[model samples]
Target: MAAPAAKQQGFYDCRDAWARTIEELAENDPRIVAVVNDSVGSSKLGGFQKKFPDRLVNVGIAEQNMVGVGAGLANGGRIPFVSAASCFLTGRALEQVKADIAYAGFNVKLVGQSSGVAYGELGPTHHSIEDFAWLRPLSNIKVVVPADSWETAEAVKWAAAYEGPVYIRLSRMPVPDLVVENRKFQPGKAETVRKGDDVTIIACGTMVHLAVQAAVELEAEGISARVLNMATISPLDEAAISAAASETGAIVTVEEANIHGGLGGAVAEHTSANLPVPIERMGFPGFVPTGSVEWLFDHFGLTATGIARSARKAIGRKRG
Candidate 1:
């Protein structure tokens, strides 16, 4: 497991990383095309548009049609990266996502921008807290939630090179870099961020950095907590989860979305079948009230302090 490095640099919005990666890939592969629902600025595709204006296809205000067009482009031998606000991208065009992309097995990279409560103030309608839950159950679709900018760039690269369907969740929220440079993105493998024995904390997306911080805090209290970055939610790293359950005796799962059918639920499903242990799932409990991302995290105990607290509670339960 990699130890958390000293706070490096300032916060960076992951969309920047996604944009840079897309442009780089486009430069190398002409087959790379971007399809968006009129979200050029929001998806951070202005530079890509400038470099390859002909490659950028904007299907204004029609998410369903936009996804359908992306699938069509894929059928025509072009690698279509469909980018849009996550809420509308997954919710409004779910049928198309299932039929045209996942079921049809098209090589389409679905980029859900501003995912989770990144658009917190935009109300629940805009909050993409259900994307993981929605996409996890589908077949032939890789569900990826990158932790930070570095992982975001790596994930985009993986999506481009790999064939078939993929959904890479990105955030507009700024976050410090978590994964180091040169670390390759391996699907269905959980990266161990911290190693310990008292308890294990498995987290995805925005919660990964917080889980690392929580493990750091747990170290001070003499409660060693193992932190696993479960970026791939669907084809979960069940081996790591089983190891954690057997070795640690307690596990705490975290995510930015609902606990039901999200990262937590995935972990629970695996552990229950293989190694049953005390598990506490942390996420938004119900309908999220409107507020800033910080407020929403606090409201639902999604912060590092909150994760550490859950870890302690899980540890106590194991002993009990």
Candidate 2:
């Protein structure tokens, strides 16, 4: 993946992809509707509202009620997207999500907009470092954190068509296109952006771009680092993970979420028991730090420089 000599003129925010998917899906399938907690604007749905005013259901600031309404809508034959900030959507209405959505298997799409540290200056209370940890344990639900605009758009299409509960964390951070244009997003499968035998860099969400950059850096240093964008967190791509471990011998897992019970924990559990290769997990150490999202990411060591350094350390350890 070569960095553009000049930053490309066409970088799509993942939110654009979300709104695009909603508009396209709604055009064909009238069942596709959006339900939010008075966050239609912040969640980037003004266009959606203009297109489908009646279909846009705003349940005010009450998170729990917002989700319950979504579940009811699903039961009534409408495909509802329960969209909200990740901190509020997953944290505030966890019970509603568990009982009304997951347990009931409602075809409600939970779009977590502005997730992770995208809340930036709002502090830890607004950060969503624990979403993966909270959602991964739930049964009968799919958790996805797409790596880039292509993955994000495809994931949205997949969730809209699939007849089950799903949670998608849409980051506020801008992303370049990954995978070919409109690539097929396979649920429960990891996409190997780069293949190598030295080490495997397993990452998802915003950290995936950093992982790919790290692999490029490693390549320049004569290290063969494979890059796996593990988009599906729950019902994780364990098979791809095991293959990376058995084939590559060393692995580095990265995420914008907490290192515990997110991408790292899932891969560690699989690799430690089955493949048992050396692993270095690069992510938040449980506490959600206070600062701008960029500052917190740098502070927590998830920038491209940080991931590269961690990959170097992991490769060294594996050689020993």
Candidate 3:
């Protein structure tokens, strides 16, 4: 059996990548502005504020008003990147997102920093696990979760130029580089990380690397598992999901979100209609426990070992 996939030697924070990309994009496009809710530090936009003082609009802890300001900026022909904590950004400003941004088709880039359980120590109140569930149902809004720093930078660049509303979910947690530095990011495409036959593991954001590691572990136990990075949650890679169902025979989905309405739910919706297959979804099952991020992930079965376990169970269901 092959050994586990080689782990990356260093770590990188996606927020740093987002900040750098935003600054670079601002250099080229004068229309790029950042709207924040008194979260300049948390969003890692200090440098941006210094460089583009007038461009950084801090709305002073008003999440809903921040979204309104962003929409207004868009109305004035400026591209606004609304950056703030995921919980407040999505939960407090959801109506603005739905009506002003999505319904109006404003070209606003909603940047949810420190998403998922990246704030695990702060408990469920700080967790943005429900953002995906909340945003995916809205029309005219593209939901994206970048797996690592490279993907985060690329996604931010893409969102800057895209002509419609986009929500980019990012984490403060450090993750190994996933995509190549210069690989062009496609909004609705899924990247195949590893190929196998017995089962398929579809994951997004931070779960992508873990899914790849899980495939390696399953290989050691004589299970062939295909791993796919389903980065774009809203415009899901339907063709890829369909092919995985037809070829792999079984499917397991991993996410750092609720199982009901995130990556797992999206995959289930696709496969159920296009091609029925045995499936297992792994994510936070309920209100999460209070602990460090690492502890919470292990506690909720969001680790590589746990993913492999789910993959094996999915294979068993396929055989049964």
Candidate 4:
């Protein structure tokens, strides 16, 4: 048997980073403001409201109009960060996101908080599994799922400074930090967390931690896996995907969204014609199950066991 894999230091929630970015950015640029649908507390914006009370616009329980209003704010030369639960922001105002923010090319940044199964006991209505499929089709909108607090802060800062529509996802679940404080946010670049040759593991958001764990477990099996924390889905790191496929010969893609059009689909889309290789996509299969978040993750094969199994399958599928 192979030796046990190494461990990281500690975990942190990206939501705190979101709040920090909001406060710091708003301090610098007066145009940087927040617009929530009565989600100041839920989205962890209470501190933000306290810090910049006049900069926040809370529209209670209205998602569609909330997005439109955000667009209007952007059109009026203000940087509006629309914060809300992902299930409501993406599902409720998907069309408005497409037309108002993306199609119109506004400078609105959509912050999807408590994404995936973060609201464990809140049921399926609170789950955000369709955001990938919903936003991936639209052009001009960058899709970002920061893996840790550092990445979250950097992505938000980058999105705010850069002009255009961007979707930045913030998770409430505790996650170990990945990049350093000096890590720069490149629009479509992939961050390599672990290097290997047997197989490559590509993941975004909370799935990134699982991929790191899977790398450790695979190391015990004498299997090497290259782990890439792919935070951007819309503008994929094609070079990294191609390199992973070419160097490792196999790839396993993971995400919290559905397997249909999320990071997995983006990887498959790139590898299809550029550098074809054995690929396995792991994520929600679109079936809302009745169980705890941990149970739901296990149900969808998102655990470390599931990720290792999928990595093994991908390695096995590699053509000699």
Candidate 5:
């Protein structure tokens, strides 16, 4: 079945929400400090710096040192939000993140900005597709990928109040707010955007809206496709995944990151152990070729049509 055309809506850059929410939190609490790798402009924390100059620390292109400084700040009772380009923040400073924050159990918020392919033509060297795979194994750190501006703000708020290590992945891509009634941000829980009986399309980060559109397309073709906004990747909503596998019988996992050791892998690991079901994983295979962000998404089948196609394939694989 062909995927239905997407309806246009107001788009938002989630980094703006992250910056605004953190500034608001800082206004109330003196302990809220932002540490960056000279990424005040990219992380959209310029306003934060202007409002609280003394609190915003720029580590000057040193990703590892920035993370270490964040850990030190946490040790001193300051809630430090380490912000940097996701590529460098996760790849260049992975050991610091695993050791200083995860293993040490610091009260730090690692904010990975411009995550995924938001870097566009900068190529795979700048793309952050490997971040989830790198950070997911660090059991102590909570991994979060917010779908839109609302979730981004909510995740920031939640991470601030929770005294533990957290990695909130944010993107500069413009996305429309999800249409969810009485929305509440519950970390490690899947938000059922659309209910169904045949198949479930689970997605995170920027791919969630595309999954919702795919579900709409499937509904028109008499295939009920449930859509889940899996904002939190690590410590996955296993209960929701189990119910989807038991009731829907088929699952399609999508993300803007690699299919390996990401949201798809998390869901697959759970379902494979508990409720065996037909599953289709969608995302980049590995190092993607250089292209515009739009091209990368379409080329890698991360769009509505692509997700709908995978949904059908998973449905076809279901045991009768």
Candidate 6:
């Protein structure tokens, strides 16, 4: 393992981008509407509420009803973005999400705000580590986890335009913007942030920048680690995974959610079936202890240094 890179200078909460992008889209599209479970402030939709008071629907702490209402709104030919905390939105209203939105094949954009451990000290009940697992099996729902502010905005814009069920996972955790040349938001396609041959680190959401930093640290030690931003968990880019597995021969999957049925599990399932490779999945094992967001990240080895360590282990497991 190599030393972590210098501390990031500035960090951005992707929720801001989500809010701004949706508001901009709403300005031109009259059908655009927002449905929340009293999370206008938390979802960073205060400005949006002020701009389109009538367009903002507050269901008052009813996650199930909120999702049902979003489905109804969609049936009425309105593009309703159902926003709420990831935990309650997915856990509380999973049936609605499965039947009303996904199974029904409604044109509703489900914006899961404060996803993963963004709720931090609020404990496991509030932590949304199982959201990916809950939604991934719902084949009709396209699950997207944006890596940064730019990606966040792009995913929102794309979801609004695409007519179908989509889940845009956003985090309150701050992260630096990735420095990818000619960056474009092509959902379900892995964006190569750094090219390497020794090992590949596939990550999404807040873990993407950390994975890039890990690749830099690995580079210092003559370890070429490829970093891929796998923003879309569902409808995964199988081609990228196959290339990384066959070319690199080793892989380390990192995500803010649980390893099972999340990004890591998705990758492992694909590779194990198509192309076998040594893989190390980095994420919460199960329910985590109470702590701040930063502490939890470090404790769970979700940091750049930890990711680099995992990458080395994966490389060591590679067989000739």
* Colliding pairs, model 6: none
Clashing pairs in 3: none
Give the least accurate 10-residue stretch of model 5, judged by summed lDDT: 1-10
Query: lDDT tens string, model 6, 28-85?
Result: 9999999999899888899999999999999999999999999999999999999999
Compare candidates 2 and 3 on lDDT and give the better one.
3
Query: TM-score, each model?
Result: 0.95, 0.94, 0.95, 0.94, 0.97, 0.97
lDDT of every predicted structure (CA atoms): 0.89, 0.86, 0.89, 0.87, 0.92, 0.93
3 against 4, candidate with superior lDDT: 3
**Sort order, lDDT high to low:** 6, 5, 1, 3, 4, 2
Clashing pairs in 2: none
* Pairs of residues clashing in candidate 1: none
Q: How far is candidate 4 from the true structure (C-alpha RMSD, Å)?
A: 4.8
Off by over 4 Å in 4: 1-9, 179-182
Query: Which is the winner by lDDT between candidate 3 and candidate 5?
Result: 5
- Off-target runs (Cα >4 Å) in candidate 6 are 1-8
> Per the 3 Å backbone cut-off, how many clashing residue pairs does candidate 2 have?
0
Candidate 2 lDDT, 184-233, residue by residue in tens: 68998998888899999999988888888888888898988999988999
When summed lDDT is taken over every stretch of 10 residues in candidate 2, the lowest stretch is 1-10
Higher-lDDT candidate among 1 and 5? 5
RMSD of each: 4.3, 3.7, 4.4, 4.8, 3.8, 3.7
Predicted structure 1: clash tally: 0
